[model samples]
Target: MRCTPPPERRDTAFALILTALFGACILLSIIIPSQICLARGGEAEEMNLSSDTALSKLTEGNESPAQEGIPVHVYITNNDNEKLDVSLFIDSELIDHKSISSGSDQKMDRYLLEKGRHTFKITWWDEDVKSSFEVEETRDITAETSVHLYTILNDKPEEYEITVNLVNENSRELEAFLYADGSFKKSKKVGKESSAELGKIKLKEGIHNLSVRWQDDDTKIEYEKTKKLMVKRD
Candidate 1:
């Protein structure tokens, strides 16, 4: 039989080879950046760059039409050294907002609006970032008017008494309908400070939505109020 190296020497030689290979790997790692290098560490997390949840609307009005509507421009910046994806807002209303890579800026514009103040909002989301912003501005509207109305109600067992107060602050007379259970109960004129009292009504109580409608006024001016009343016997 041919002589062969002892088991211990063979084991030692194999171990030395493994050590050399490990050292070479370490040197290469120190010299090269991996394609899958981590962009950022997990020290903190961010949210969506376009995820926002607040909204606001403001109106502006001018006695004379010659005035200008509001003009507004909003700007967003990635203030963090880390690239940020975020949204911006004016007064809780959302404009176009976006993700900003690190050290970048963005801008958006909207009508300042007339007769009321408007809310602007911005939003964003990402795997590790979430943010938002807002602003408010006022502009003048030349020819439109607004009126707000409400209802007062008290409920008794198997019956309800409701008082509808209709007021028109506009220079023109306004009319609207009072409804219950999808049926028109009454139509009344609501002129400047003119209001009518609707008599008591009996209703089976659960969940009900009360809606008020009028024409010749801003279609955006519909007033919807919800009331939850329970009917119980004494």
Candidate 2:
């Protein structure tokens, strides 16, 4: 007959086996989940980075200029009661012509214009009435500028005045010279965000010439403008 093992020894062996198995299970439970979470978190971070990159690209595209050109805004309004067929010209170049209904307004096609003075002309085409009225206007517009034009009847037909309004929209100051009838009238220095008026120049019943020469201290660019004013003496 074989000798039997001690009861305490057997009990100790069973407890050790159970403890080893429990430790293995606990380690698997903790380590497996941690690995899964790390994988998921890595994927989420990659996706977020891609999304942020796409958004940054979109913002940059929108901020950049559509084309390598300057921006100018031109607005035209029809204040007359009658419908008008309007023809618009810039520097004697025909840009657009359209029929505008009464009391309606329209915007012109945006195009980059050269800096300096430009002649703007508007002609009305009336089928019923043959009118010989044409409006000619001039302005010195820089890059990224907005200009407005309108018509106003003078109170006196014989004597009228033209107002020269100078505004320095640049960052630096500007030295300007005013000329009336081909003669230098005055000189002024206009600061940024400030405006200087050359005052109302009285004119007799004739065509008068007005011009301005200015130098921008920031850009060091010299700009000049010449416009004609026609006055009818009653």
Candidate 3:
């Protein structure tokens, strides 16, 4: 017992001990970094999944009914014989301008509006005509409505020249007679998709009686319309 172990045996034992310790240190260095990497990867995946779910919810909310608006349809027409250059305005803001020919119609693009009262303005070049309407609530998310505008020329500018227009919207032909103050003035033949005009009549400046008589071809019935005209010198 007092004698020391052999050098060879001692050296071999020490070499084995050192080798075991080195292997343990190398295994610990690799395993610790691997566990840390796994933890970080899992956290990153969870964060990305949460972000995608939030984006999906936000997109669905935007497409919901509570975020939608109302829809409006507007139609404009020029019933006069002259070409019309007009502008459309909503709430005093100009939206569009168009040039429409005689007896032609123009439809504006469908617009989205908030629920409430609004003012629509139609300007014929420099002249102005403003109209007000309301948009009511609907059971659906968006409400649909329509408005029509027609420009009619009904004024006399001179004593020697007078213009009267008769519009025929029926499917049958019509014969229109014009009378001023109980006297026959002129006659015009107006058919479907056409208009009749009685121009250049000699009349005095005063309150006068005006009458128009037409026969309906489809119903074989006669209709008469009478109005009072006041001619003034310009």
Scored by TM-score, the top model is 3
**What C-alpha lDDT do the candidate models reach, one value each?**
0.42, 0.58, 0.58
Candidate 3 lDDT over 116-228, as tens digits, reads 77666676732322332222222222357766666665333445456777666656566777778788878877776566665557666777777777766656677767778
lDDT of 2 by residue, 1-234 (tens): 222122220001000000234234334333432121224533632112233443354346445455655666666676665667777788898888777766676776676877778888776754434443467878886668765444222222345665677765656666768777888877777776667775666666777777777765556667776767676644
lDDT of 1 by residue, 1-234 (tens): 122122220001000000234234334333442122232554433332111211111112313367566555455555444544565544564545466665566554444555454444444433332333332333334444222111112122354555455545545565666566566666666555444553455555455545445654545455433334444432
Looking at candidate 3, what is the lDDT of residue 117?
73
Which is the winner by lDDT between candidate 1 and candidate 2? 2
The TM-score-based order of candidates, best leading, equals 3, 2, 1
The C-alpha TM-scores of every prediction are 0.26, 0.35, 0.35
lDDT of 3: 0.58
Q: Where does candidate 2 have its weakest 10-residue lDDT segment? A: 9-18
